[model samples]
Target: MIAIYPGSFDPITLGHIDIIERGAKLFDRVIVAVLSNPSKKPLFTVDKRIEQITECTQHIANVKVDSFVGLTVEYAKLHHAGVLLRGLRVLSDFEKELQMAHTNKTLNHDIETVFLATTKEYSFLSSSIVKEIAQFGGTIDHLVSENVAQDMYSKYQNQ
Candidate 1:
């Protein structure tokens, strides 16, 4: 069945890619949906995030990249996706993710939220953490895809 993996993906990290790769194996189709939020200043634009995710996931034939601006459940409905895939990295992540899953369930009972345990290697990885490291001139080569790491370096070159 089609599954929608929704997130800001401000700059997709290796952790995010890990989840997408695993999700693709479980679902017939996996759409990496980037959320378009105007409130928070993101390192990358929605379009750029989509492009990065697309590039990183190109090897997975069943994975698609897109952006959305409204409720995630609505987006899932629009795509006729039966599952909303999410990644759980730790106990803290479980609490927040569980709450989001419950809230989404209230909005749409048909779509199920599935949580995938992040690979142990990526348990402590996140886009924010990567950006923080990059902002301070730390090596993020191991935190994100090579393309994403290059883009991050390019973006922070002038900062």
Candidate 2:
């Protein structure tokens, strides 16, 4: 079945990649849909975020990268995706994700929300954490892909 893995993916952390890779294996197609939110100032533009996700997920044959600018359920419907795939790292994530799933269900009863438990190693990894480390000149090579690390470094170097 087609599943949409929707997120801001500001820089596509390894945690995100882990979810995408695993989701790709479970679904016939896993679209890594980037949410285009103008209100939040993201380090990378929507186009750049899409490119980063594409680069990181290139090895996963069933993964596709795209951007959307509306409710995630709407995006899933527009793309004919039957599932909304999400990753759960901890109880806090569960609380928030569960709420979103319920909200999406209310918006579209036909679509299902599937949650995957994150790998132990990446339980604490997140895009915000990765960006925080890079912003402080800390090593983020272990938190994200090499390409993403370089991109983060390049973006922060000018600041």
Candidate 3:
């Protein structure tokens, strides 16, 4: 079944890639969707996020990259994705993701939200954390891919 893995993906981290890779194995097709959230200012644009995710996931034939600006469930419905793949790294993530799953369920009952526990190595990883580290001149080589690390470093180069 087709699955939609939606997120802001603002400078997608290895943790996000890990979830996408794992999700790709579970679904017939996995769409890595970058959410264009206007409310919060993101370091990278939606298109940039899509490009990064595409570059990182090119090895996975079943994985496709896209961007969205509306409700996630609606996006899943548009793509006919039966599952909404989410990654949980900790207890707080569970609570937040569970709430979103319930909200999405109300929006579209046909789509199911599947939660995957993040790999142990990425349990403490996140895009924000990576950005934070890179912003303060800390090395983020371990949290993001080489290309992503370069991109992130460039963003904070003048600081």
Candidate 4:
């Protein structure tokens, strides 16, 4: 089965990679989709985010990285992916994910969302936090992949 892991992924964090690595093992194909939300101010552009994802996930076989500027369900339909992979960090994430899962299911009844609880070590890791650290000139070497850290630093410096 093909699974679509959709996220803004402003900069691909190690937590995100952990989920991708785990999710990749479950499905024949895994698509790491970078979501484009016009309402939010994302530090990284769609192209930049896609580039980071590509660089970070280059070693993962059977995994493809791409970007979508519409609803995730719509993207899933376009890719013929029947499963949506989500990683939950804690209870705080459950409610929101539950709502999204239901909404996606309503949009595409055939599409099902599978939630994977993040590993304890990565439960607190997120792109927002990584960006915040990098923005404040703090080290994010542990939060994101080396390529991601470098890209984020480059973006931060340019801004």
Q: What's the CA error at residue 39 for candidate 1, in Å?
A: 0.9
Model 2 regions lying over 4 Å from their true place: none
Give the per-residue lDDT of model 1 (tens digit) for 1-159.
999999998789889999999999999999999999888899989888888898999999999999999999999999999999999999999999999999999999999999999999999988889999999999999988999999999999977
Stretches of candidate 4 exceeding 4 Å from the true structure: none
Model-by-model lDDT, in order?
0.93, 0.93, 0.90, 0.91
lDDT by residue (55-125, candidate 2, tens digit) is: 89889999989998989999999999999999999999999999999998999999999999999999998
The candidate maximizing lDDT is: 1
lDDT of 3 by residue, 24-143 (tens): 889999998888888999998777778888889999999999998899999999999999999999999999999999999899989899999999999999888888889899998999
TM-score of each: 0.98, 0.98, 0.97, 0.96
Model 3 misplaced stretches (Cα beyond 4 Å): none
Write down the worst ten-residue block by lDDT for model 4: 145-154
Residues 4-73 of candidate 4 have per-residue lDDT tens digits of 9999998788889999999999999999998889999988889988988888888889899998888999
- List candidate 1 stretches off by more than 4 Å: none
Rate residue 21 of model 4 by lDDT. Answer: 93
Task: Give model 1's TM-score versus the native structure.
Answer: 0.98
> Which model, 2 or 3, shows the larger TM-score?
2
